[model samples]
Each structure stands twice: as structure tokens, then as C-alpha cells.
Target: MAISKPAVPPRIPCQQCPLRPRPSFRDFTEDELDFVASFKVAETPAEPGMAIMVEGERNPSLYTVLSGWGFRYKILEDGRRQILNYVLPGDMIGLQGNVMKEMQHSVEALTRMTLCTFERERFPQLFRSQPTLAFDITWIAAREESMLDEHLLSVGRRSAYERAAYLLAFLDARAQAAVASHTELRQLPLTQQHVADTLGLSLVHTNKTLRKLMDQGLVRWLDRGCEIIDAAGLYRAAEWRPPKEGARPFI
Candidate 1:
């Protein structure tokens, strides 16, 4: 039996999604949209464990996550992989390459990931045509860099419980933004291995850490997703505070 491919959703919804929630079209006149739309194309679907880009490959293009989650990681010479971070909906994966010229780490789908790719060369024209889109894209890249910096702090300075607490707090904020609620949040779709790699913990330690959080009434797991049972407590445990500017800065 031949397997059927999933139908690609029309791009119009991308212009309308609550996540996009900005004046994207205003950045480009109709002429520019029409011109750029011609080059827009559906990408091949990436399976849950597939690598989108290897560490040393030429950066292919800027990727807009149309669906699913992905993460980046760097493997040590001894072959241990330390996951860099997670990319969720409305996130772009290759913006760093815009400056670096090549990928420094591998990016892989953490779920059945769908994306829309814009080539590097076409990006200049696209940005020139849609200044707002360019700004949004730049803002997203800076946000990702800030997140990585925060993750570095968590791994470098936080204890196991603190690390787990920080992950819970972060996900609660992200899910509330992306999926609509923190209390109702569940179904994170991330496995223990993913959590371990992401938190820079051994699998055993991650498991223990999660159980401790559950025991402390700080977080709960249900329906394959985690819910913050005590947001204030979790934040305190993680030593988390919204930055003074209300957002972390890229540096």
C-alpha cells in the first residue's frame, strides 16, 4: 500500500494565526507579496527523529516552524550530545546562520515537524520587501539567543531541582502563549530522553528531579503534558524573575 502524504496547509492561515499576531502584510505591498509568494514553496515533512541540518552542513535557509517542535544540539568529541534548546511554534531555526554562514550544531525534529523554508539569497529581497517581517524575524532570533543564554545559566549554575523547576516555569509561559493556557496545559509531547538532554542531566537524574518536583506540589504530569500546580512556588524554586526589561536580551 502506498502511504499518502499529509496535505500542506495553505499559507494564508500563516498570515492570520494568533501566533503571528502582528502587522506582517503591512510590511510589504501587494506587489512584493505577489513577487515573493512565487518563490514560496512547501517543504518536505520532517519525521520526529530526523535531523534537519547536520552540524557542519551549509545552512540551507531560514525555517519557519509551521508545526511541531525541534531542538538543537552539539555533540562532544566523546560523542555525548548536549541539547542546546527547544524551538516551538512561530519560531525560526536558521537565523543564526544568517551571520555565521554555517551551522555549529545539529537541528532535529522533536516531533513531526513541518516548516516553510526561505532561501538565504532570497531573504535579502524578502526582508527589503517586508520590513515588518524582517523585524519580527530579527526579534525572534534575538529571543532565541536570549533563551540559550538563560539555558546556559540554568545548566551552569542551577542544581537539579532548580533546573527542573526552571524548565517547568519556562514551558508554562510558552504554552500559555502558544496553546492558550497554563493551568490547562498538558501534552508537552516531549520524552524523558529529550528532557534529560535539554536540561543537561542524565536520564536518571532528570527522572529523579521530575519526581521531586511532583512530590513538592510544584508541577504535575497528566495526559503526557506537564502542568504547573504552583506557579509562584515553581518560580521561586527556579530563582526565576522576569528580566527588568520584561524580556531577556541577546548578547
Candidate 2:
């Protein structure tokens, strides 16, 4: 897995950020936007399967997903990997690196991705000067924690079929919120192996669960992805309802 500095930095002026105007995303004031624009260091690009940040490394920067998909995960001594969560567009990555001296988990790209880098040292200044931005950062962290809690509940207590249904509905809702374009909602970039790791099931078990969902017309497996056929059906099967969320800030 390789990480490279963008040869030609992608100009992502905060004022023109595509996510800022979306109802799912909060708008930034000119002053706040200007601060963020200046705070941004550069664009970093990662190819599919590249490790953006490694476990136990002391990374100097934090990042926001400018585009594409990635995931947070941890590997055990036995090399068993557990995918903690998906990182979609506008999601923050490496916030833990700022609080802890070393990263406790790793982040890897699932698709070709671009990330907006921010020097970790400037985070304190941001908090002191931009209270609203600081609050948004806290909100993002809380949201991540909430999702983790739900994932824990699903893996620990739910039946395999219910777990599979919850995961599909969760990802479908998150992916739909992240993209402005409706066409992107039809498919998610996930494989059976990713599903297995996330759901804490063996690959065989994951496939069986997914096949059942497909048979019920809840979802369909693509060559390298999954398509949600009936999101409501999946939610019903899981007995889950997504919490209402406010416009989220894109840091």
C-alpha cells in the first residue's frame, strides 16, 4: 500500500466545497471558511488498498475525506482484522491521532481517495479561535462513537440475519447522506470479506446471510459491491431506525 503527495494539489476552496451547501452538511461562515482554507495544508491522494495511516504510528496530521471511501480498522496479533467503521466523504479521519500520541487503529482506502490534510499542531488554535468549528468537531466525534455503539450492539446481541440487515441499512443511510448526487446511492463499495470483518462473521457465514437478503429482495451483490434493493425492508428485518441527524459540518 502506497501513499503519495498529490503531484498537483487539488484546489478545494472552502467557499466552493460541494458538501457545504447540502442539507446534510452545515454551512460555514466566510470567516470560518477562510480559516479552514488557510488551515488546510495540502491534498493527499491514496490509491485503493493503500494504508493512509498505520496502527501505532504517530501521524502529524489529521484529514477530512475530500472524496471516495475508506475504513477504520484494527488487526490482532493473530492477524485477524476488524473493520470498525466506514469513512465516507466529509468524514474526519485521524482525530484520534490528535488526542493520543499514537494511532490506536489504522485507516485504509477502499477506493481511490483524496484527503485534505491539516497540521495537528493547529488544532488547539482552531478550538480557541473558532468555537463553532470546535463544537462541530466534537459533534463528529460523538456521532462516530454513537455508530460504534450501535455496531457493538449488533455484533454482540443480534442474530446473524439481523446483524446483516442492520449493517446494510446503516451503510445505505450513511452513503446516501454523504453524496449529493442520487445515483451514488444505488451501490456501495463493499465486498463479502469487508462484510465478514465488519460483522465479525466468517466469510462463508457472511455470504450466506447476504444471499438470504438477496433472496428476500432486500439487497443484491454486485461484482465488487452491494446494492440496496429495499432499505426499509432491511431496517424492518433488523428492527432498527436511524436517528435523525442535523446538518453536519465538513472539517
Regions of model 1 farther than 4 Å from truth: 1-13, 21-39, 181-183, 221-227, 243-251
- After superposition on all CA atoms, what RMSD does each candidate show versus the true structure? 4.4, 3.6
Best by lDDT: 2
Query: lDDT score, residue 151, model 2?
Result: 97
Q: What is candidate 1's CA lDDT for residue 227?
A: 63
TM-score of each: 0.79, 0.94
Model 2, runs deviating above 4 Å: 1-6
lDDT at 115, model 1: 77
Model 1: ten consecutive residues of lowest lDDT: 242-251
Clashing pairs in 1: 187-225
lDDT of each: 0.70, 0.89
